[model samples]
Target: MPQPAGFAFLERDGVVVITHHGRTATTLRGARAADFLEDVEDGDAQEIMARLTGNYRRGNERQARNHPRNKGR
Candidate 1:
């Protein structure tokens, strides 16, 4: 799988705004924002942000697309 890019975040006044490709994708606030900040600091920020925004692939698309039932679409 390819690495996720173009994911950025901004935190202000206890609000966390997550953007993908320069557009707003999700906003985290309160406890969620705090948790996100911690996670970003602890691990890969791009992966975390992609997962939080539901933008990461589940690694099943290729198999699903090649399944017998899905053949000859």
Candidate 2:
């Protein structure tokens, strides 16, 4: 079991970038609040983020699909 490395949280030009190693997470706040990762450069960051978010959303969708909070939808 290895501990994870420290992560860097950066805010630049209204874009917040969270990076650890080569992985990155990004968030934008304003009229449109969007949260995602910065992983479209010349590396495996896109693939890594795709896999990570896929799993994350899958679990969330599963929970939401059965939750009563969204019963009308």
Candidate 3:
């Protein structure tokens, strides 16, 4: 997947930290993540972040904006 600019995440010490545009959007600690993820139908931490911060959309935009069809329009 294409990565959004300035989007970074780190999972350390059983805690998940998400940053978008260089600012923290949310954090998931061990206890909370366990509780939350357990109920999730079929999603892992990385998928959660990708949906939350719209990283995929950004990546698509980044890629599309350079296409010839988008030029000067």
Candidate 4:
């Protein structure tokens, strides 16, 4: 899958503000903010942000579409 774009994060005063395409998607505070900072330092920030904002795919779209029950739809 293509990497997600337009996701950004800003940290301030123990808060993490996440945005997509210039709009706020979610805000992380306290332990959540700390964990997010740690994860971003160790992995793909874009993927992480996309997942946090409920914007990432579940990797089953093609399988669902091809299932016998959905084949004709």
Which residue pairs come into collision in candidate 3?
A: none
Model 1 residue runs over 4 Å out of place are 55-73
Residues 1-73, candidate 3: write the lDDT tens digits: 5643454566677776777766786777878656545534475545556565553333478678899999997
To one decimal, what is the Cα RMSD in angstroms of model 1 from the true structure?
5.1
lDDT of 1: 0.92
Order the numbered candidates by lDDT, best leading: 1, 4, 3, 2
Candidate 3: residue 3 lDDT (0-100): 41
True-structure lDDT of candidate 2: 0.46
Worst 10 residues of 4 by lDDT: 50-59
TM-score between model 3 and native: 0.38
Candidate models: Cα lDDT each: 0.92, 0.46, 0.62, 0.91
Model 3 spans > 4 angstroms off: 1-6, 31-47, 53-73
Tens-digit lDDT track of model 4 for 13-70: 9999999888888999999999999999999999999988894445699989999999
List model 2 lDDT by residue over 1-73, tens digit each. 3433334445566665555554554444543222333343344544544333332222378678788988888
For model 2, what is the error of residue 14's alpha carbon versus the real structure, in angstroms, after optimal superposition?
1.6
TM-score of 2: 0.29
Report how far residue 33 has shifted in candidate 3, in Å. 4.1
Error of 1 at 14 (Å): 0.4
Give the number of the best model, judged by TM-score.
1
Per-residue alpha-carbon lDDT of model 1 for 37-65, expressed as tens digits?
99999999999999999944556999999
